[model samples]
Target: MEIYALYGPSGTGKSTSALALAHKYNINAIIDDGLLIYQGKKVAGQSAKYEKTTVQAVKRAIFFWEEHADAVKEAINHYPIERLLVLGTSRKMIHRIQGALALPEIHHYINIEEIRSSAEIKAALFDRGTQGRHVIPIPRIQVEQDFIHRLIAKVDKIFSPKKEEIGETTIVHPQFQTGKIHVSELAMKKIAIQSCEHLPFIESFRKVKVDITNTPVVEVDASFIIHLGQNVNDLANTIQQHIYDAFLEFMDLEVEQIRIVVSHIQIESPAHA
Candidate 1:
């Protein structure tokens, strides 16, 4: 079990690089905040795209993170500190945790500060909505040499998952491949809600409040797709069309990319699925 910690200033591509490492190393389990995780070969993580920059949105994002504590803890325990390839920043936080946990094999906390260039460190204002700064550096924290050694041991575990989960092509995580894949033009919270209105899936849906123009990115829970339609394929197709048009109508451009997160799937119900 090997734990490689990747963290740097925001937008430094820590998560992105971690994903790439996972794919390359053939490792499993990536734990992070604001990620729409799923059980599949590949998962698309998402955050709702917003047109208006507001303080409320920032609070909500933070609140949502607090809510996932149990889920994250479970994932860490199941895999142990050894197997986790963490996208983290709080060294003091991680250190305190390390002191508490009595796992001898858990070694390795590879800080990604080595990758962040000085150019990236320079601060610049970004159009990121309610969030503080789009990309801010997390100050480096010094840890004791003894702790570093212990962490290193845990990280060097037997690479589990027999057979080649990722063959000759080793790119463990998509996030590592690039920065967040956001359809900025389509920033909507509700999938079926937005789909029903612009795309014409359901008859009754409230209007989406966020601005779609200028910013064209959107967010969706890939798993939580519409199922209560007459036909699933028809719903899927209609949903795709709606997402496309919304991008054009709001953002006033052709949709270059559509990042889907298959996080939620509508199950069959007594009324309809």
Candidate 2:
């Protein structure tokens, strides 16, 4: 596989702009913070951001643990990757990840200075130092389950010059500031059910499944039946919007995705046949 590196100091917006860079370079897989990201999905390995201390986080990032190294290596072997991007603070750090993953020698190097302005770097560092926010190149759904104490936020959508949507990035606070906060799956299900309770055409919710695996940014799968004569498309859209708005208003949490499935439709009968 062809290998490329993006080298820079930590918190210099490397991770923030990783997706756009990958699009420009045509790299399909990325190795960042000890995770293997393919096509915007995390397929294997735990993130270094989950480490409790800076030293341990560094160790995890460079694949110091045998299990960690082996897991990422296995994932690389499993996927048919053509080109890969390795992100790190320095060439030495990139080389360490390369050796750990047994990838080819670096075919190209892209420096943070080439991509981000000095002002942007300063802003990023300020955010990192004061807010403890770190960017993961994958989407929020990919890393939500792994981050409990951290506040997770999704980066805005990026587009190529031609207007092709590249993907998204996630901001996370890795260092635990407060104790772990737990939001139960049942609670989320209730929220989903309650949100759609008042919709005109929604007869009843047949099944509601809330995935807290990705905490803070939750994914809801709701199966319900709607009254006949109701436009399925319109009902689905309204239900999705209601659930999303409800979560944001009530819990102050972002709804990453809501999938509304119409399992049945109720048709009203005339007085006489």
Candidate 1: Cα lDDT at 163: 40
Q: Residues 60-139, candidate 1, lDDT per residue (tens digit)?
A: 22323444444444445654233555454455534433333322333555566565333222211122222222310110
Q: What are the per-residue Cα lDDT tens digits for candidate 2 across 220-244?
A: 3444454445567887888888888
- Give the distance in Å from residue 139's predicted Cα in candidate 1 to where it truly belongs: 30
lDDT of each: 0.37, 0.77
- The all-Cα superposition gives candidate 2 an RMSD in Å to the true structure of 13.0
State how far residue 264 of model 2 sits from its true place (Å): 64
Model 2, position 122, has a per-residue lDDT of 57
Q: Which candidate is the best by lDDT?
A: 2
Angstrom error of the Cα, residue 39, model 1: value is 8.1
Clashing pairs in 2: none
